[model samples]
Target: MTLATLALTWRHLPAAPPCPRPRVRTSEAVLLSVATLALLLGISQTTTWGWVDPRTLGLFAVGGLAMAGWVWLTLRHDEPLIDLRSAFRGAAAAPNITALLAGAGMYMGLTLLMVLVQVDTPSGWGLGQPVAVAGLMLVPYSAMSVLGSRISLWVGARISPGRVLPIGCALYLASTVQLALGHDHVWQALLSMALAGLGSGSTFATLPVLLVRAVPAGETSSALAFNQVLRYIGFSVGSAVGVTVLGLVSGPVPDEHGFVAAMAVNAGVWVLAIGVVVRAIAAR
Candidate 1:
């Protein structure tokens, strides 16, 4: 499946355009990578070591300081890794922020679904589905994501792309609520995942365009790349948080209550993203 998808996109992929050379700042790059690695390590281990553990705390501290230095260096450097200035100001800021939150919610909710369907029913809440069946249930989600992107593009002709974000997020919000209420049946879980895919597809498709429109043509690529970094970090954090939540609530096996709680939290995240997008749209 992955190979076929890559083959399909290969022909349509655009050739890389030439641009002026950037002065590489090796130290800054290393520092930023350190920050990212530290953050990932800290978050990923939270399920094993509690959040208050000294190692976790120290990792976060180091990552924070490193990130601060990286930001400071970027602001002063002649050729920075990311064009943070343009991204943080004006219309760019709204979409970037939305991407961060929406990415987090999307991953968190999806991860929870994976766990909810497969965990052993020791706690009397899980369906205890086999791994293969649980994974197969997500096929509908991937399908809908593709369809949602096409729908977003079609709607773009009539409605502003920025306006589509809240609508997508609302779909996600609806899915989370539905999952939280009932995910015992295979159909229910698949439906919730489909809705999630729809939201994620539209949200991801619109974010790059928004960044492109907000920044100078020369800076657009770097700006979008930076936004992608934000999304990746958000996804990592969400994955770690979801695992931590479920682990904390699990005994010999995970509980359905944990899944419910996690879904509810994600629903709130969707609401937050929707509110931010809507407010940004209204302000414009």
Candidate 2:
């Protein structure tokens, strides 16, 4: 779902021109497109990846290795299928930090959410959803990123998306806290999910707007793609942190309290992001 948002956001980004009749005729886009297809093929062929147990932690390691390969390859390209150079600390911290922090924080916070609902029967607060059903809960939120894209466009047509992004981030944080407070039924989950989606959706939409403002024209595509890569990295890290937190906590009946603890850790990200934006505006 988040993958879809990342794609949509990248699509909406103010793009750079294709190199004028490049000598090699192989640009970063072509390389990345091939890589994406390869990744998709790997995912689609997982069932056939036999010998290795599908449910084992080894799958996780395999996935990580795939990503590492992607990153490594991206860096190796002479023109870089996705430029890492632009992501340096050169620009104002607002865009740079906001992109990095939000990327990681969003992943971590969202990962925390899945566990909040999926903890075993012993955990009192869970919805006890099987893996499939639990996965479906995210469908609505996934749909919302498209909504976020629209919201960003509308907002961008007026004031800066920089202003809009913080607003979105705050709403997301509030949603996290509210969900932490607890839900008696699926509706609460739905509501919280919507709010959460709206917030994340908004950020996903707006960040590129912010990125374009902060980066130079030549580096736009690579910068934007890298921004997205950071987000994927964030999701992995966030999921891991959430799982780790669950292991350390008390058994069963994991309630609003558990979610809150996770949020407490995530809240620092928002604080740091807000500081970046604040300082950026102050410098302006």
User: Which candidate has the highest lDDT of all?
Assistant: 1
RMSD, each candidate, Å? Answer: 2.8, 7.0
Candidate 1 residue-wise lDDT at 58: 97
Taking all chains together, each candidate's TM-score versus the true structure is 0.89, 0.68
lDDT of 1 by residue, 1-284 (tens): 99998988897888668877777789888988999989878987777787999999999999999999999999996668887776777889888888888888988988898887887674567767999988887798899889888888778768898888788889888888998998778788999989988877888888887788888877887888778878988897787777777766664466877777777778888889988888888888
lDDT of 2 by residue, 146-174 (tens): 78768867987898666787877776777
Each prediction's whole-model lDDT (CA) = 0.83, 0.65
Candidate 1 clashing pairs, residues 3+ apart or interchain: none
Q: In model 1, where is the ten-residue run with the lowest total lDDT?
A: 245-254
Kindly report the root-mean-square deviation of model 1 from the true structure over all alpha carbons: 2.8
